[model samples]
Target: MTTMTRAELGALGEQLAVDHLTGQGWAILARNWRCRYGELDVIATDPGTRTVVFVEVKTRSGDGFGGLAYAVPPEKVRRLRRLAGAWLVGQQSHWDEVRLDVIGVRIGRCRIPEITHLQGVG
Candidate 1:
């Protein structure tokens, strides 16, 4: 198989993540939402729970950079929270709950890529 570039791998991972979310019946609100702070990988709503979720997607080819658990450190979580706040301020909708989640996509290790989702991360 041909080697995938970093950007291509990331994009593929994000697309897989979106597919996973939609398969779970979640309504995607935004993706790659950008601001001065940074970009949010995905934003979606849980219709059943009436919650708004902010997602951070980390894509990896292997266990490099300490793997998925170490991808979103405390500082990164803080930044994500700030980004979520910035996103919320511009919204006209309200929800019963808001949460931060991390989705780690690991590719090139097996026939199928592995996906790990951590909820309420921050």
Candidate 2:
């Protein structure tokens, strides 16, 4: 068994998120996209709906603090929306719709990693 650091865990979660999104037919556009506002974990375009999705991934060892979904607060969602707007301003192409998504990753001892995706969060 091996112990994972916080950074390692976060990276793993983000990678898992990207893989999951790709599996769902989303084309990854960016990862860790940063700006003066904040950072977006994963940005993708949905092939089926032609929607631009701004994904926020939250990884945790357990629910010691709170459930994975609860990690992303209302203010965070608002900020993500702002980030999405900024990202859109820089994009060359257009999307039919813009959505805010949240991917919650939970890692616990002796348990498989749990991933939950909440689309159109805010």
Candidate 3:
């Protein structure tokens, strides 16, 4: 088997997250949605709940740093909120519940990646 490099692994983690969200019945609205404030990795809509989810993807190969979720700070959340608003405007989405979700992808040593979904990071 071909060992995935850093970038490839990171990309795989992100794609897995998108697919995971899709499996959860979320309609993917945008990927890498950007604004002046910051970028939202994935913007998905839950038609059943009428909610918009702004996703931040954090991929890690090891616990070298604190943790993957640590990358998403409060300021980052604020920035994501702004970008989420812009996305909403573009999509004309009137959502009752706007949430921030952090997907932490942990690549263990010779193991399948693990996904942790933390909602309302703010």
Candidate 4:
């Protein structure tokens, strides 16, 4: 089997994350949304709670860089918060609550990739 590049892996992870979220009954608002600061990987609303979630997707082939636990550092969380704020400012709709989440996708080990979703990370 051929190996996937970093970009390919990331794209696949993001798509898998989107599929996972949608499967959980969440409505996707935006994807790969960017601003001056950085990009927000995924923005979706939790249908049950009516909350907006900003998700950061980390993809890896194996347990590297300290695995999923260390995938999103404090600085990264701050950056995600800034990006989320920037995104929220341009919107007319308002959410009662906003949350930061990290989704870690581990591929190439099993037939199906493993997805770990950490909610309210920041």
How big is the positional error of residue 79 in model 4, measured in Å on the Cα after superposition?
0.7
2 against 4, candidate with superior TM-score: 4
Candidate 2 — which residues are off by over 4 angstroms? none
Top-lDDT candidate index:
4
Error of 1 at 95 (Å): 0.9
TM-score of each: 0.94, 0.92, 0.84, 0.97
Top-TM-score candidate index: 4
Q: Rate the local accuracy (lDDT) of all candidates.
A: 0.91, 0.88, 0.82, 0.93
Ranking of models by TM-score: 4, 1, 2, 3
Better of 1 and 4 by TM-score: 4
lDDT of 4 by residue, 22-108 (tens): 999999999999999989999999988969999999998887788676888899988999999999999999998999988999997
Q: Higher-lDDT candidate among 2 and 4? A: 4
Runs in model 4 lying further than 4 Å from the true structure = none
Clashing pairs in 1: none
C-alpha positional error of residue 99 in candidate 3 after TM-score superposition, expressed in Å: 0.6
